[model samples]
Structure formats: C-alpha cells, structure tokens
Target: MPSLHAIIPAGGAGTRLWPVSRAGHPKFLLDLTGSGRSLLQQTYDRLVPLVGTAGVNVITGARHRDAVVAQLPDLPGDQVVAEPAPRDSMPAIGLMAALIRRRDPDALVASFAADHLIRGEDRFQDAVRQAADVAREGFVTTIGLRPTSPSTAYGYIEAGDALTAAPDAATVLRFVEKPEVDLAREYLRAGTFRWNAGMFVSRADVMLDHLRREQPRLHAGIEEIAAAWGDSDRDAVLERTWPTLTKIAIDHALAEPVAAAGGVAMVRADFGWSDIGDFAAVSGAVHAGETDLGIVGDPRDVAAIDSSGIVVTSGRAVSLLGVDDIVVVDTPDALLVTTRARAQQVKELVDHWRDAGREDLL
Candidate 1:
C-alpha cells in the first residue's frame, strides 16, 4: 500500500447544519459526533491508518487551511493543499491527482469527503484495499455502500457483472441520481443498487486521463496550476486560473461518463456510513444517550422527559417535554428549532437569513 495516497476535499459549508456549522467554521471542523475529534480529523484518522500521515493530502479552502493543519499535527505542511475558491469537487480532486501524477505516476489515489462518518473500520479498510486493487486494473473504482433502506437522500450505483480479477468488485452499470421514494424502493428490492458514497479509488495517471478526456478545459487548467504548485509563482497561477476551471462535481466530470463506457467498478461496503447532511441525519448518526436522545453537547446539560430527537446546545441547559422527533440547536448568536422530518429544509432557513443580510448568524 506504499503506492496509495488519500485525498480529502474539505470545503463544504454544511449550510443545512447552520449555527453549529458556519462558513467560518464549517461542518468538517466541528465535533458533530461528540467524539472530541472533528469530522475532518476523523476522516484523517480513518485514512492515516491506511496511509501514513505523509500519504494523506487535504484539499481545503484557503480560509480553513490553518485550522485543518492545526487539527492534524505531524502531517507535512505542503500536503494541506488550499484552494483559492470553491470550484467544486472536480477541480479539488483533479489538482491532487495531477500533483500525485507528477510525483508518482503509478500511485493510487483514493478520494473521500471530509464530512462523512463511517463505522466498522476493518470493513472499510477491506473495501478500500479491494477498490485499490480494482483501480490498479485500470478501472475508475468506487465503493458503494450496501443499501440499508429505501433512502432517497443518496444517489445509487447500479452494480453489474462481477470482475474476474477481483470477485468482490463488480462492474458498475451506471450511476443513478437520487430517485423518488418509489424508485428508491425498486432499487432496494433489486439488490443491485448501492448508495453512492462518492468514495473513489484510481491510479493517478488513469484518473487524470479520464479527466483529460471528459473535461479537457478543466483538466488543462488543473495541470497548469499543478505545474506551478511547487514553484513560488504557485499562488499567482492558482489565483489566475482556478476561477476559469469549470464548477462541476467528479460524478458528472468523471464517474458517470466513465461508468457509461463500462470503465467504472463498485466495491460493496456494509460499514455504517452517513454524510449527516441535515439535522435529521445528525439525530440518527450521533450516539444516543440513555434517554434515547442525540445530544451533541453535555448530556447533563440536556434534560428530556419522555421526549426524543437531537439537542445541540452551547453551554445552556436545554429541556424537552413531550416532544418527539424534534431538533433544537442553541447557539450564542442564533437558535434553530425544527423537526427531523423538516431537517433537510434547514438550508432554506440559512438562505432566508442570508437574504435578510444576517451574515453574523451564518
């Protein structure tokens, strides 16, 4: 696994989790799970064990560079690649791929989000190892989480025939968008669909080649920036050219198109996984207290009597009575109260505040 390096693109604002997750301190930086380690640190922890600190590179916004560096000590400073602006996942990942290609053409790169949570460490490592094996075979491989339910919140990966080289790895037929509940249930019943976890493994040259073919303009810009990455003029090149790169995710820029051409592979994963996109998800992902409530702060600070849901408090006592499936987030500047069912709509609330010119709350 010496040839393996992990890249984490950590730039999302996690607006759906506003107040707790602000633009200044995004979701990846906060300890959403009460594990003391931030999500980014947890992501780092997961990958660092597979590839040492030097082998893990972080691609984050310029604003978060220092914090990311602070969270994970002993990692080479240069490995914390900062972006001038958010051009989406494609450019962030593509830049790392280009950089890795320059250093080790044969290196295998695995991309995982900074905010995702995964359980069952051994199963995750096994899936990654298998995905890496499939990647070395020239396939743009992805780890597809086995569907636990008819979850419309996530996109689906359609697994096709199994590859002979790696029996546990299957040829990906296509990538499906987040479907309606009915369609999701159909996919669940088929058993051939897995939640698209957006985790990918591929050889550095292979990934760049796919990028070069599908998104030549974006690829060229990325290459230009990467060429100057090691030089003093790196900032000038990045500032000038990063804005010109296309704003697209890797799924559209690489995964879907590659999968359509029968060049994508899927490794089944059963490890408990969650992106924790909203408060509803947060309620489920966090460890429940004895009262069966998800508390992000001190459990003693929160008192619940025959109530449920999550309460993220900021050093204030929170009490719940006869409330069910509720979400109460208390911050110094603002507070959020909503139900788990309406959690996905929290981003809309953030937008409302933004439109109202309440940047302080954001």
Candidate 2:
C-alpha cells in the first residue's frame, strides 16, 4: 500500500454531554470510556498504526490547541494545525488536505473525527485499508458502518453497485439525513443502507480538484492560506482570509454533490463504532460489561440500592435508590439529572444555561 496520511478534525463542544463536557473541555478531551486515555488520544492511537505518528495531522480550534497538544505529546507541534475560529469540518479538513498536498502531492488523505469509539481494531484497520485502495483509484471513499439496528440517530448511506476494481467497495448512491423511526426501520429492512460514520478518504489532489469545482470561493481561500503556510505571513493571511471563507460541513460542501455526480465510493465497516453523541451512548458503553448500573467516576464513590442507571461522580460520593434508567452526572460546578430516554436532549440544558446567563456552568 502507498503512504496514507491521516487527518483528524477535532472541533465540537459536545453540548449533549454537558457538565462533564464543557466549552473549555469538550468530549474529545474527556476520558468518557474510563480507559485512562481521552477520546482524541484514542483516535490518535488508532491512526498511528495505519500512518506513522509523523504522517498524522490534527486540526482543532485555536482555543483548544494547547489541550490537544498536551494530550498527544508525541505528535509534532507543527502537525497540530489550529484554526483561528470554527468554520466546521470542510474548512478544517480542506486546510489539512492543502497542506498535505504541499508536502506530497501524491499523498492519500483519510479524514476521521476525533470523538468516536471503536471496538475490533483489526476490522477497523482492514476497512480503512480497503477504503484507501478505493480512494487511490480516484474515487472519494467513505467507510460506511454496517447498520446493526433501526437507528434514527444516524444518517444513512445507500450503497449502489459493487466496484470491480475493489470488490469490498461500493458506489455510494446517496447520503440521507436522519429519518424518522418508521423510515429508519424501512431502511434497516432494505439491506442496502449503512450508517454514515463520517470517515472520508481521497487523494489530496482529487479532493482539492472537487473543492475547486464545487465550492470555488472556499477552494480559493484555502489555497491562498496553504500557499503561505510555511512563510512568516501565514498567520496574517489566515486571520484576514479565514473569517471571510464559507462556513459549511464537508458533507454538504463536497460529499453529497460529488456522490450525485458519480464520484463517491463506500467501504463496508463491520466493526463496533460509536460517535458517543449523547449520555445514552456513554451509559451503554460504560455499562456494557456491568449487570445494571454504569459508573463513570471512581466505583468506590458510588453506592446503588435498587438502582439500575448510570452515575458519574466527581469527588463526592453519590448514592442512588430505586432509580431506573436515570443519568446523574456530578461535577464540581454543575450536576445533571435525567433519564436515558432524554439523553439526546441534554443540549437543551446547555442552551438554557446560556439563556439564563450562567456561562460559568457551561
């Protein structure tokens, strides 16, 4: 296999997992899985095998640059590209692609989010290898997770004809948004849809060419910034030009349109994966081996009596009695109490805090 560079885009507040996940310390920086490593660290660990530490690059917001760097000390300082502000995934990944092309024009770049959990490392690596092989053939490839259930929480990618060049690869027919419960069930029964895990792979030049044709202004701005990347005027050019660039996701800016024009491919990923988007997912992962309750903090700090829910404590002891399917997160400043069913709506609490002028809690 040819040399493949990995780009990790790590920028999200993870408001749904508030109290523990705040603006200054987001989900990617937290050890939500009790594995002694942060989500970003785990992401780096997974990619280091495919592409050596030198081939991996991380793009994050300027505010969290220090934290990201501190967590991944082995990564080269220059590889951590800090954006002046958040312009979503497109600008972040595009900037990394431009920089990679500058260094090696024939480089194959694979972009993955920094906040996700995956079991079965061997399978994951195999899927990425296949995706890279497909991408080298000039197709924008994405790793599509095999749907295990009728999940309404994730978007779906419909697979079309199988590719002759790479048998494991398929033509991506379309990218569908999150559908209703019944529609999700229908999609599950169809056997042609896969969960959109947001894993994209493509050659740096091919990606840049698509961006130039699809989003001309964004393409031009990133090119200008990439041209001045190694020069002393890089910061000056970025500060003046970044804010003026379009703020859109890679899905809308590149993937969807490219798929419609027959330039997208999919690789079936049969490994266990979770974006950990909410407390429900956290609870499930933490309690996968447990009998009833899930405890995130120190186990000795929690005492459960007739309770079967998730409990996260800071320094204080938390006691629960007769509670079922509940979520309790206790931090030094804020505490969250809700049921697992409403875990997806925890972002509303963050919005409420903002409205009530309680920025400190957030």
Backbone collision count in every prediction? 0, 0
RMSD of 2: 1.0
lDDT of candidate 2 over 30-118, digit per residue (tens): 99978899999999999999999998999999999999999999999999999999999999999999999999989999999999999
> Per-candidate RMSD vs. true structure?
1.1, 1.0
TM-score for each prediction? Answer: 0.98, 0.98
lDDT of 1 at 70: 95
lDDT of 1 by residue, 1-362 (tens): 43999999999999999879999999999989788889999899999888888889999999999999999887889999999999999999999989988998789999999999889989999999999999999999999999898987899999999987565899999999999999999999999999999999999899999999999999999999999988999999999999999999999999999999999998988999998888888888887857668999888898899988999988999999999989999998899999998998899999999999998888
- lDDT agreement with native, every candidate: 0.93, 0.92
